[model samples]
Target chain A: MASLPPKHRLQSSAADSAATGQHEHHRPRGLMRWVLTTNHKEIGTLYLIFSLTMFLIGGVFALVVRAELFQPGLQLVQPEFFNQMTTMHGLIMVFGAVMPAFVGLANWMVPLQIGAPDMALPRLNNFSFWLLPIAFTLMLSTLFMPGGAPNFGWTFYAPLSTTYAPPSTTFFILSLHIAGISSILGAINIIATILNLRAPGMRMMDMTLFVWTWLITAFLLIAVMPVLAGVVTMMLMDINFGTSFFNAGGGGDPVLFQHLFWFFGHPEVYIMILPAFGIVSVIIPTFARKRLFGYASMVYATASIAILSFLVWAHHMFVVGLPLVAELFFMYSTMLIAVPTGVKVFNWITTLFRGSISFEPAMLFAIAFVVLFTIGGFSGLMLAISPADFQYHDTYFVVAHFHYVLVPGAVFSIMAAVYYWLPKWTGHYPHLRLSQWHFWLSVIGVNLTFFPMHFSGLAGMPRRIPDYSLQFADFNMVSSIGAFMFGLSQLLFVVIVIMCVRGGKTAPAKAWDGAEDLEWTVPSPAPLHTFEHPPQYRPVEH
Target chain B: MVNVVEDRRPQVRRTVIKTLVVLAGMCVFAFALVPLYDVFCQVTGLNGKTASSAQSLVHQEVDDERTVTMQFVTRGAAGLPWRLEVEERQIRVHPGQSAEVHFTFRNLGERSLVARAVPSVTPSPASLHLRKLVCFCFENQRLAAGESFTAPLVFQLTRDLPPEIKAVTLVYTLYPQENDTVTAAMPDDGKHIDAVATRRWADRSSGGET
Candidate 1:
């Protein structure tokens, strides 16, 4: 491959694309380009920026919620609006922020890593990216609707969500349907891209952990997003038409809604986090200057986690009066998930074992992800025990568990990925001093915000409540303050990305010395068209 | 380059379409869960919604010495504008014998309201053992403005009810049906038959209790 000469190879590939007249790089200039272009990179940029905007909007909702909960009394918003705040915050953060952020990363990274020219279905990619804003706009518009937004919580358990829902509930369901459609289409596009568009030499097993992880994540998305659409459609029928699917008088069972919801909801959790596993796998090894330990086992572990995710949704409903056998089955399956998860944690640690480690900003975030995500895993295990879950379910401890997993587990990996790939995307190294400051403040602020939740939850504080007894006031105050600090710190991340994108210090093609992937082989600030002809592959020994 | 990708287009199209078809099928399957849930409940008697009116009565020996404390709880759905209170909040019932409790529902809203009550049994396993011989939940009640009516819930605890469950709570939630005037706009099918069948199933499931 080295004998072919880089200049000649590039010339031939460029000639090949130009002769076809398909690589005509002239595009519609200005906003029209974004609105109409089918380029994967442009669409990925749109997905990412859109998610970041949602994150900020959702963050505002969270801050309003925290401000109200700062003291025992409702000092800011009314209780009803406060309910709306919490509901919108959970919905936006889960669907609009975290999930899309991961998908955005997949869109940018998977094609580059796999040595493909672009996503398999570039047009569908644009469609997926565009649906998000329309869906989210419709969802956010509900806040101004006659009865305000959904106050039944994001889970939207039935009877409450069905018969008592606001008139806007129909719109909310429609918006969810649109968003679900976006996700399903996005998943299909990813699956097609991964299966059919890989470079000739890159076998399934030869791909990086990120590519493998996305393949599985896309499959999970395809499998479950439709189920969510299904459940919401039933909610629509119950609210508008006369259907007792979840009505007891109409011979419909309320618990059946929960069953159907969690069946989708459980795997939904993994859909958000499995990609984090992939991002961490890439970052930790690069920083550690070592090949990822237990590479095959890591793949197997990811697959097992995905398979087990389907079995463990009922762990969320232990307090709903499940029979002993059902409880035990869900309990045992939930605990079994811990095994593959443990394998992943152990693999990351082993990869870091006394290797030539360097503490860059991305590495810092990746390391934090490992330590904090494990704490989350431990709390998850505690909740998995059916007997203990009876005490923990719906409590702030449950709140603490998920936030620890999501904030540090998923969100941190996203930060690390941005930092890790910023140079390649922007052709400039990020401002290092400010980057470090952003990372530390975020870590501290996150702990401050969520750590006290454990104590309050164990002391009998239920979640989704605006007011609490005087005993919880002090902890709530601490949590609220921490939340404000954390929320403000994200502004620094925005500043850093802006400063970097404006050209800080020019970076080379291979941004990091130890980084060894197809992405690094391309020039910094990757061109609009990449890998038009698949790049030749060279096998590396561990 | 165009030919290379174009050559593979049909296969990719097939795969994409197949994936989409699977997604649509899954959505349909989700709707299917409604009927599936009903069938599952009927089979296991899991949700206290076993509406099969074809059961032959099994008269087991009455356990006169055994009594279970049954609590009745009532709640009004939002916008229902109804005040609901159980005439008797708690009752002691003997196994294999029927019991009746009355609930007073007063529609405070200044309009004719059609409301239906839905019931749930707690300690869920107990659902299989508690049989409803006559319950207000069997049909929708249409109440005029300011109308107050006392509806009765007649039920029994079977002798086969596990001895471990000494207490069971039955909660009835009142939801105002979509305004009866709105039904005229919808295509009229014989939905009346479902209500009738539901009542008949309730009757046969607990036939001899009264």
Candidate 2:
């Protein structure tokens, strides 16, 4: 692995890129410019905007669920609709919102970081991004279908999702297949670009942590997206073709569904979070005015987490009558994940220790990600203990545990990346005052929304239910209020991106004082074409 | 730069092709997991499915000192209307000796229905040696409404069966079958046309309520 590149090398690349200023002007105009664009930046913009739209849509689905759970009685939605909301919320957030957002960031950054002119396959990139809208549109239209959208939980355990599934289940299976194909394509492009397109003389180890994580994440995507495709295809068969892959009535085991889903699913959890680790890894060091602690260790830890994710899938099936030995194997393997995760958290903290740390919005989210994501991790550890999980399974405690990791851990990291890179993307600093307001409100709102779930879940409030008894009413009420608060503050984020794009404080080529990635080597608001000529090669010295 | 990009084109294309191949293999691997999961459960005896089929059955002298209790329990899958009852609900047997248990199934549904009863074992490890010589689970049964059909379940537990397992409970759950071949086997009582009967069957299977 190459050591950290020294600062002077950046100036040379910048001068070299500036010298070759031949930006192309023959792009398609108006709607077709976006519709048929193959440029990485344009596709990146489409992915980000698309993810944000999905985020809002998924957020409303959450609000609907929250509204129904605001009291003991089901006031806002029926039990059937409640199931749809929860299912859609999980599906949309994971597949539509979070995954796309990360890919969008990767598209915008991986090429720039590696000094490539574009993604390895730009047209494929366009196709992958376009697949999502079709996949999600098909999924959403199922709400209007006779039997309604997938009412099984996001896991879609069969025979519930097969023999007993609504008429819309086949469509659900198709939509997921489309999305899985999209993910596989996107992953291939990333791996190709990273492996084959780095600037001359920059070895694999010299690449930025963001690029490193995406590379690993991309391989994971390739490996597991197909399994997802496989599992859903099985679902499709069971639903339409009368095959019994999951239908116990047909001699297929329902437990097999959990095994297959989690095989794809547990790794999918890491798919959402590993890049967040990379983002925070990038942001914490930049704002702290320090080189990242244990950069090699961080990469190893990310890999370790991805590997361990596979072995720990059965932990999710602990309550399903797994044999004792199987239970212990999954439980121990799951707990072992904490070691690598601990390394990451410790590395971040060490980077921040006694450094010239700044309280920028990006830094704030990065730090919050450290504190709150750890909270999620602790709950995860609690849930990992096979016996304790019996108490917490399907409870709001389980709900609280994941939401903490997802909202604060993954979503916050995305926020941090957006804030950290906004200057480079738009050539202007975000409105600082409004950004701070969004930050504080989001932090408070997120905590308020998910914290009480631990109490209610311990009090035995199950998840995905439209009604709870009177004991959980107060927690549900406070949670709904916080949900609205958290949901509304995200609108401010949309405003900040728009305002920063339109006009704001100017940012120089090197956006942050301590930033060292090659992305900053190009001018802020990077040109359509960059690194057309591979900049003269010189690996930086630490 | 154009030369660098062009030079790497072959490598990128190779990498993409290889990755796509892996993607296809994994998709196939997921389907492979179906039989693999069943095999895994059978080997571990974790899901109550037996690993020992008739081919693996071997001759063994009876272990006179050890007696094992075999009990029969039957249930129906969601909407199955047949009631399965064994003539001998509980029987004591020597580990290596063969035993035959008779089961009677009566279709409670209005029309003749095709059914299959799948067997499972409790304290799952015991299933590893629970061999079936002749069981009705090997084929489907069609019983007319209120008609009772009897079948024999002949099985042997190897003498090597662990002494710690004094008792084994075999649960057989009846599930309605809809195979095209079975439809011919089903004696139509002239209750309704083929289309209407099938629609009702489909509705009953999915609806959870007849």
Candidate 3:
């Protein structure tokens, strides 16, 4: 594979001497670079901005939903429109918001962290990011179609999605197919880059936790995204060809849909959160001014969680009806997850115990994730109880549980990561007061919005309903108010990010007193092309 | 040179072991795929046995249009209390045609409710069938109280319903009423029908509860 001969290298060196510093001037300039470029960093920036825009759009949809549910009796939108809100909100946040945000972070950070010139497959990376806008365009365009957007919820289960689905479902499925392809290609690129392009002497164990988690997450993506593609394809076939893969008359079972979905679905959940674990793992240590506690255990625990994720998916289906023995098996396997998860939490707390700590916005979000992710985990355990799930399944309880995981768990970590790395990316610190307000308001608003859902769910309020009875009125009202506040608080984050980007007080190479990482070893406002040569690896001493 | 050769030998051995282990793992993984898939199906109810049947009820015709008061009884899943209401409260259908009815259900419990409608015919062995056109309970119904919306069901006398079947009765089961108070008020007697039961039956089936 080493195609360049020694003579060619020598001649190139002679040519390089002739134009030593002129290379920078010759770099690609203007809009042509952005539109028809293969630069990893530029594509990464585009992905981040695009994801942020989608996040706001999805947040608006959520605000609409919360507004209607605020006082109960259809104040903001009709039932059909409300259903569209829920459906589109879920689709956008998952595919457009969270996943893209993580990919953006990966694109920006992975090459620099790994001491590579750029992503191994730069063209594929550009293709992945560009596919997103096209996919989302198709998805959003469905809202204007006849009979409105998909109202059967994001899961798009059988029969409802097949027989009763709107004309827009075809477009929805095609859009998701494009998105899935993008995800798969992105995952493959990440894997190949990590495995094949590491700087000489940069071993697997020497890599940062974020890189490792993403490597595994990429594997999970390759393994299961195809399954998602398979299921959705079957859905399309069922819709078009009159196949019964999910229909009874066609000698197929509808519950099979749930099984196949959760297979991909469970791993998909981990895909969203494992990067969160990596993010927290990085941020917690930086704030604590100490090497991570139980580093090996953290790695093993993450691997254990990924493996356990497959076994425990049936917990989602306990109410769908299964044999008692199978139920017990799934229940126990699901509960066992709490053990490894507990290990991660304990390690984080121990890292924080005696170390000098400062509550920067990043640290604030990290600590909040520790507390709230546990809440989500506890609710998951509750749902794991097969008999207990008979009550909680598909109710507001389940809704509250996942929101706890996703919002406080995944979304907060993304915020923390942004705040933590903002200095490095921008060469300046973000506005402190605004960042603090963003943190506090998000903390309060998120809890207010999701907390009452537990009560309403326990009160027998089902999820995905356009409207509810008078009894659930108060909690829904509080939640809706909380949701609006939460939505508005995110705008503060956007402002903080924008202000930091436009330029703020210049930062030192080492931005935080406690921060210690190879990334900080480089100059702030990282060079367009970074670490052309690998840095020496030195283990941190406790 | 001798020392470097010795180091290379161990590296080679380690690489061989790693490769063998990975190959073994791959084989195991490939072997497990089918069983794992089957288990996945069974657990997720992908087998279709656990799902509600879409088979319509055999339709029956009644010779008379006399106002026959058909009673509905409902019991919800445990720990979920529901209240149901119909917009018109009743419907009149011709001997050969169908009628559409709308019923709304509310969750009065402090917790979220997961309820499904199990449509049963009142006269056993009668050929009368009910076809749901639009229903909230088709998959499952999640209702937040102070939150209520109507679900519509379309049904016709399948033309095969026994002529002897004059009126059809639909029963809904709302299990696990959220509060003990709600459950205690109604008890599990064959006769007594409460708000939760009335709501579930109305929302689930097309009949008035007395």
Candidate 4:
């Protein structure tokens, strides 16, 4: 119906799926297929499902933490257990929920968007995806261990995490090692796929921002995940090997541990959010029916942000008694980051200006991400001031600032990506009424949970504590209620996803009006192998 | 299709190898942070690990015009059974002049115990210029049951101490050690784990900040 090459490719892909399905039917069925299958789509589905499950698990831990903080006294859990909840919540959310979800999205979309048949190394993809559950299992099992799970907070600052840590700290480190291996391997696979598999005519610049951002994100993952592995390994040595890497009495400084953790930590945050920038870039333009404004600038801005991420790691350590010169240097470098971040915000807004804007669920989430993420950005700038950081560091304000970025920024963007692509994945249009409800409830719940934290933090409530002074009572109660509301509202998201996947009105190949990517060129529920031959890329006339 | 897939395999292998190399390098770099952090601190004196020998304590003329109140504070960690107290609560000393302070420690516990006193000076900027000639914190102290001992600390604040600082506090927290060694909880947040060292400074002209 279209042109010769695409038509031929589609026919062959359909035949390919049918024949493969027949062969798959003859092979060991059920879980064996998932365990051994090299199909990108199936593996992507596994990753997405796994991340969703982890999301719920991490959410429960968060609720437990909020519940205990509901009152001044310890209400639901002991102090140590509360610490475990806070620690595990941070670990599971960052590693299990956010990182894997981004990787899952990359697994599904990177090859399709780039006109590749599958991931560059399909078997490696399966290995990476499977390693996650094992790592998390080992980590979660530590909760039941004799000494309990890691309770030193997720940042796991030294002296706290090293000498005085629980016995389960070794398990936590090993689990992180496993997880880091998965991330590094996953990053390698993504880099290979994006570099090697692009269609014949598609220029690097012409690729979707999602793919571009991922290419950058993959590099970041490769660069920093090993640093995480290395740092945790050093922590391991310090714990058991009689190494005084962070022991002051052994002539090692504790502040050195902060330096290493934040070096990995700062880049890790960008790894979660850069892909978010790419996703928002794609969705905002599509729903606005406008060519993304200043596409070149957007790409440069992302690169700048990545480059600047390394320079700002020391900013997190201002209160650790850095020299005055070092403090001033870190402060200026941190504030300079606001310049490139402003460039990105300006570009997104410019893309939305005077266009045929629509209010789909995806757009609503994207819009909210822009607004709320900026609020987080403003708070971050406020924290960058060295003197001010002394007041805000380790406080609820820090908690609120990160949540605003993560829950509303990174987590919200993932929801946006899912809603935007669900029709294509399921071959069924999403139930709009349900999705809208999910979006509104999520936006409301996110704000309610994180907003009051700013005030509490400002009023001098330190984080990672089981109980706060009575002064923080009212705000904690409101935050806990909001957290529960947010947790419950996500069930609606599950319902929406399940309902769409099961059956609904069929969606056409072009699910949305403004869709013009290579992915949309294929039929809905893209055949097992969508692009056996590279799809032709023709520039659209402006 | 078969040809294309086969041809790209080596390229994929190459990128994968390259990425693995980067990953390995980063891992090595991470472990490198240990010595790197040490060198950084040594160069900058940022971590407050002062090297008295490295500093050339030239005799800059004493500031006769201004006198700063030097205070000694002693705190016992929660688990510590030793009662530690400073001999002099406060003293007035001019910049560049050496001062000696005494602290008394008594083993209140029934058993003989090993205690280590870790010293910290604040405001921290002044700690950089405040050099110690001899300190009891440099060694471990063992006290028999009911035994009491007094240890002396001799230090001089260099003339480089900022004019704004009219006072300085030197705190020594006595921590009970195990197996003849102090625990690793010496730096940052000493209050939580074992003993604590908190030095408070209040300029006479300016009100107490804390």
Q: Which structure among the candidates has the greatest DockQ?
A: 2
Question: What are the per-residue Cα lDDT tens digits for candidate 2 across A328-437?
Answer: 99999999999999999999999999999989999999999999999999999999999999999999999999999999999999999999998888778899999999
Residue A526, candidate 2: C-alpha displacement in angstroms:
1.4
Question: What interface root-mean-square deviation (Å) does model 1 yield?
Answer: 2.1
Q: For candidate 4, give the lDDT of residue A183.
A: 89
Report the CA-based lDDT of candidate 1 relative to the real structure: 0.83
- Model 4 residue runs over 4 Å out of place are A1-27, A468-473, A540-542, B52-70, B92-97, B123-130, B158-169, B175-210
Global lDDT of model 2 = 0.85
Shift in Å, residue A202, candidate 2: 1.2
Cα lDDT for residue A5, candidate 2: 19
Which model is ahead, 1 or 2, in terms of lDDT?
2
- What's the DockQ of model 1? 0.43
Model 2 lDDT tens row, B25-83: 88889889988988888678888875222323358889999999999999877787778
- Model 2 lDDT at residue A402: 97
TM-score of chain A of 3: 0.95
Pairwise DockQ winner, candidates 1 and 4? 1
DockQ of 2: 0.50
Flag clash pairs in model 4: B77-B195
Q: Write candidate 3's Cα lDDT for A1-542 as tens digits.
A: 00011121221234443542365455455666666556667777888888889999999999888887877676768889999999999999999999998888888778767766567667778899889999999999999999999998888888688767898998999999999989987887777667756656778887788888898888777777777777777889988886667664334557678877888899899999999998999999888888889888888899999999889878888876565777899999999999989999999999999988889999999999999999999998899888899988889999999999999999999899899888877778888999999999999999999999999999999898868899999999899888988999988888888888877888787898887767786667665555554556565543
Residue A435's lDDT within candidate 3 is 93
Docking class of predicted structure 1:
acceptable
TM-score of candidate 4 on Cα atoms, chains taken together: 0.89
**TM-score versus the correct structure, for each prediction:** 0.89, 0.91, 0.73, 0.89
